[model samples]
Target: MIPGVMEAAVLNKPMDIELKQVPVPGIKEDEALIRVHCIGVCGSDVHYYEHGRIGRYVVEKPIILGHELAGEVVQVGAGVTNVSVGDRVAVEPGVACGRCEYCKSGRYNLCPDVVFMATPPVDGAWAEYVAVRSDFLFQLPDGISFEQGALLEPLSVGMHAMIRGRVNPSDRLLVTGLGPIGLLAIQAAKIYGVTEIYATDIVPFRQDLAIEMGATAVINPAKEDLKERIAELTSGRGVTVIVESSGNGRAIPDALTTVNRGGRVVLVGMPAAKEIPVDINTIIDGEIDVYGLFRYANTYPSAIQALGRSDIDVERVITHKYALKDIQEAVEVARTEKETSIKVMIYPQL
Candidate 1:
């Protein structure tokens, strides 16, 4: 073990973070010690830092916040074989009980007995080192930097959403909200061969970038009529698919109203609001298929393979980078709706 404590970004309270020296976590027989290299400043981490909780996961105690991460293995426990000392990898951050029915059925991501990082109570990886489960570590391919590796979490999420929506090459898609997930959704929709993609966002910067990233049309829901624009773009037939990544309370109804009679609607974002009014009558009338996403299962392998192909050009999605010491500033930057940036990565070793 390293004799002394390590520097960490500790959230002792809501809106309070300090650079403190904390003891490194111990590794078990099935775990490994990882020196965190890149930690992405995810919105959930910012939410916990700024608000002290996300939904039911209250920050009852001081917690370190970060989930999107990539690192180098510093030590491997006796039972570990897939990774060794000095291997660069991206940590999946979720450990599920293999004995569960969900795990046995290949739906491990939905396992009730799962310990996911950064979901409040559980301490996350915003530090110099972390003791991670060997099974959660994925080796980074050559030429894919730690920054891109950290991005795999969100990219995998978008890919899962795309898959859930049953995206087809002939489907016309409408994506509501261009936040990081929405931006990735736009890219993923293109990869799904959706010839026409309409993206809606309240921010002009994100709207412009959506166009740059190949959105057939970008509309500001506040400034433009969403239903009309989607209708006009799709020649009045409406979009064949809708990917709601914004988590905005009202987008649910917007999606229900904008999609074609038999279209598919996939929910990727977790809404913060207590509840949003949905047009049940309209959904029944249209016979729209709504799919809910809960993290991802059987996705990492496909995500890594797709990353190797590099045919999707998802690398351009990362818009900002910061050092580990600058994590607070990185959080603020990512919180900004004014900035034109999409994904933000924190390089811990830099």
Candidate 2:
């Protein structure tokens, strides 16, 4: 039975999280109402919690802030048929306008009218229940847990990064970050049959997690010379592809020099500076292809299949968990505990 009112971790302003009772959302004919089981605190979520905005997305009012989520379908609109009530599913946060040119060409992630959750103005699934479009939901098989289901959002980012970089068995991959997205990128590269994966991060905890996530070697950029190590690792040939998941300004420029000629670079993380100095000569002379990944498009089904592999365990990155009522602490841990915590998960139903 669904209740008329449910508790939500509402962000009224920067650093203020309150548990307020809000009316359960009404679904459209093509929507489904999910009883949120778990939600993961994303970097953007933490950013909003701290500064009240990410670039152009400003938190102007009270809003629920969590997009990485999975749950059970408690109710469905009359037109919903793909998923029934009681189905366990992962929620894809971006709802695109299906008729846009980008959507028609299978690049829906670039849709101009996308309604991305936890992005300002769109109240997300930090609440006990959320209503979303039915088509954006993917059913989780028996083997996939709700935690893994919630992680599909970040996993899809990695999958899309690999896809954008055109990663393959023959390519050597250099991942410049060991955060949740970077760790998942290493796993995604492994799934693509790329055995030689080198990951870099300043955090020892994340570097160790990188190795655990299937990186061939982990490097601490602060202590070791990244380009020199890459040259040594590849015998001066350099890696065939680079996935830049660390928003650190220096990571991209250093990674560009380590990419082999005619190689690809996928930029997954948003750096602090809107524009950072990059080696244009290196990009031009090396003929490197640079692709900016903005969330994922058309990756849910395949990502779910990939997660079924016995070795692909995404939960390894989840270092912290909390109940929805403790959202302030959850976001605080995620915001301040960068060195210790990787992914902070929340159980709304708790």
Candidate 3:
């Protein structure tokens, strides 16, 4: 039997998390109730817990903050038919309004009124049970664990980055940042048949993770000159494609110099500064194509298929795990332990 109420980790204010008893969310006619098994601690979740906001989205009230989640369906609404009770599934956090122009064009990630889970106003899947749109949930095969299911959210971003950059088999890729997204981008590039993949990071741990995740070589930009390294690696021709996931303003300019003429640059990470200086001359002269990536659209199905392959193991990115009761520590680790932590996961049912 489903309980009427459940325990939830709510962010009351900046640096404050409370475990409170809340009524289980009632589902709409087209929704399904999921018993959340695993939820990944995202960078945005930590930012909200630490500063109470990300850009314009502010925490005006206490809210549950987790978006990367996967679980089993506990119940389904009358109109729901996509998934049934007892099915393990991965929930796509963004529920875009299908009537919008962006959604009609199949670019729903740009939906102006997208209700993304854990993005300020929308309460997310950090609780024992979460109700979500039935269509947004994708069934997870037996080969894919709940942890890998949760990771599909970030992995979708990596996949979207490759899509935006128009990644091809012949491309020599340069991923500037070995964070979760950058490492996953390497895997995505490899999946797309790109053979020569190079990655960069300032931290030694992430650099090591880059190689483990499928990078041909990892460059520590702090210790070595990134431009010189890229030049030597590509035999002075520079990389054919660049995916900038570091979100560091300084790295943007450096990455621009390492790409070959007519290379594609996909900006996946949001930089702290609203505006940063870039070389317009390089972009014009080199005829470089730059693409900005928002959240992913229509990537859940492919992400599931990709992660389900025996060869693609995204679980390796997980560095820490915690039960929902210990969400405070989980957020702290993701926030302060940048050097050691990559992805922190939480099990709400534990």
By lDDT, the best candidate is 2
Model 2, residue 238: distance off in Å is 1.7
Q: Residue-wise lDDT of candidate 1 within 156-215, one digit each (tens)?
A: 777788888999888888888888788778777766677788888888888887887778
As a whole number from 0 to 100, the lDDT of residue 218 in candidate 1 is: 89
lDDT of 2 by residue, 1-350 (tens): 89999999999999888999999999999999999999999999999998999998999999899999999999999999999999999999999999989999999999999999999899998999999999999999998999999999999999999889889999999999888999999888878889999999989899888988899898888899887898888888778999999988887887787788899989988888888888899999999999999999998899899889988889999999999998889999999998999999999989
Write down the worst ten-residue block by lDDT for model 3: 304-313
User: Please, what is the TM-score per model?
Assistant: 0.93, 0.98, 0.98
Q: Which 10-residue span in candidate 1 carries the lowest summed lDDT?
A: 305-314
In terms of TM-score, how similar is model 3 to the real structure? Answer: 0.98
Query: What would the TM-score be for candidate 2 when compared with the true structure?
Result: 0.98
**Which residue pairs clash in candidate 3?**
none
Residue 159 lDDT in candidate 3:
91
Q: How high is the CA lDDT of each candidate model?
A: 0.82, 0.92, 0.90
Q: Could you tell which candidate, 1 or 2, scores higher by TM-score?
A: 2
